[model samples]
Target: MPVIAVLALDGVPGHELTGPGMCFGTAARHHPHVAYELRYCTAPGFRGTGSPAPFRIDTPWGLEGLADADTVLLPGHAGFRDEPEPEVADALRAAADRGSRIGAFGTGTFTLAATGLLDRCRAATGRQYAAELARRHPRVEVDPEGAVVDADPFHSAAGVLGGLDLCLHLITLDHGVPVAIETERQVFMQLHAPAGAEDATGPAIRHGTGPHSLGPTIRWMEAHLDHPLTLNDIADHAGLTVRGLNRRFRAETGLSPLQYLLRARVQAAQRLLERGDEPVERIATRTGLGTPANLRHHFQHHTGTGPRIYRTAFRSMVAALTWADGKHAEPAEPDGPAGADTDPGPSGSADDRRAARRRT
Candidate 1:
């Protein structure tokens, strides 16, 4: 199992300290195969204080714990504006030298910057402190607007949600998109306390300008992913000519309109695969891929696996996870059972079910 060492400092944000665990723990719980050992460490003789809630903490590990960690995470603390302890800086430097991925959350960027590891690397801190970070560390390029900055081997995030994004991203790097997507859904469920509801992120483009400029258009695309939406249709919805739409869409999101739509469709298919034993043909139609072959081609291209294998793998993983947790794996439900096949297939007719059954 990979080891992730989180450095707990005085006044560390409670949310940041636990955010990575929520993501990694959920991945482990759901998939079991993508397990990680999360370790919490602190500086020598450290008696840390939790943020917002005045409480004391005692960490189990010291700076030595970072020596062999696969990744090191630094959560923002009360004294982030001040220089990090000399021993802490040295430990971080040694970890970097040994090729450990180091990340800072929120104002923790200041601590990382002080160590000189982020010099000449792009980093992100809280927007309110962006100017101060740039002024203090002239060599570091500070992105005030970005939620997270990925400077290989070294990363930084803006705030709590940014920290969550970074944690999911690291999981994605370690495992794959499938595991990451499921973990994201699990985190969303915990945040919203809702059952079987879609997360707000919704498999859309993550890196983009604010929704103020393209909210309606993006929401429309998300709502109509099951439709055979063309460029003209999207442009019409946006009330822009093709050329203008292309320009503006590219600006709002890094992808072109069709590219974004296709990604959304593929992601939607992934969720279906992870959540249930839906047939590939039905999933393809529901996700607007139109045909199983098309779904397979694009799904493989984007996720590096076929839909059938993806579903089978998820089921097997969940079963293995259940067994590992000292629980018996639930028996599989009978195929096409009443209420199980209630979801209408592509054609909204009984023939659609027959066709899906045949294809499956």
Candidate 2:
């Protein structure tokens, strides 16, 4: 099991701490073997205050808790524009030197940046603060629109919601997409809905009326992901020319038609890989990537791993989750080539796809 230490700074956003806690806690409940031991630690002489509200937080551990952590998370706070305490900065540097992965959410990136560990690395913070982050730390490449930036052991997210994205990304890395998706649904979905109600509508379904509406066309594209599609095909279905489609797509979704198609295909493939037992080649065929080679190429390009590795990790996580529920099953070992693909982070649909496209 991995150990995660969340730094509890004064004025930390309540959601930043609770959001990751919810995600990691949910994963532990469903998959004990891959669970993480989460700790909340404060710097020496710590005086804690809540964010987006006024409250108090009392943590049990001090700076020493970061010594043996597998990962250290820094959450946003009202004082993000200010430098962290010297002791906090030193402790973070030591943790990074020891090779513990570090993650920052919202304004937390500022604290991490203050440590000088993020120099020459890509990172992100809320769009409103992105310019300021860049102005303050020119060595760090700041992305204004990215939801998440994974610079290996150092990761950062753009907003409060991006905190959940960062946590889900970490879960996906520790376990796999299956566990991450389950945890995500648990965190984001309504709990009181009827059993079958959730599965009845796919993510693409939207209820609205407008001239800039691409809802019907998006739903069509999602439903037909298994078919080989072209920009012209999408334009034709949407009753517009290719150029007109491109304008509408960029205006409404901030993605080109082809980019949108590719994302939809990748998302569909991920679902198939996570929930089914099909071979990579079959999944590729089903998702209209044409061949396993094509799937591997695109999957690695989009997710940073190959299809077989994704299947193994996802299936193993599913098995672990099921096992925790007392179901008897053996997980398939990850036997493919060493390099397997995983999602870049929390991304889906038009808005998420746009953010991902910008990161690439």
Candidate 1 structure lDDT: 0.71
Winning model by lDDT: 1
Predicted structure 2: lDDT: 0.70
Could you tell me which 10 consecutive residues in candidate 1 have the lowest summed lDDT? 341-350
TM-score quality measure for candidate 1: 0.56
At residue 279, what lDDT does model 2 achieve? 90
* Cα-based TM-score, every candidate: 0.56, 0.56
**Pairs of colliding residues, candidate 2:** 305-340, 305-341, 306-340, 306-341
Error of 1 at 357 (Å): 37
Candidate 1 residue-wise lDDT, 34-63, digit = tens? 668999898865565554544566666888
lDDT of each: 0.71, 0.70
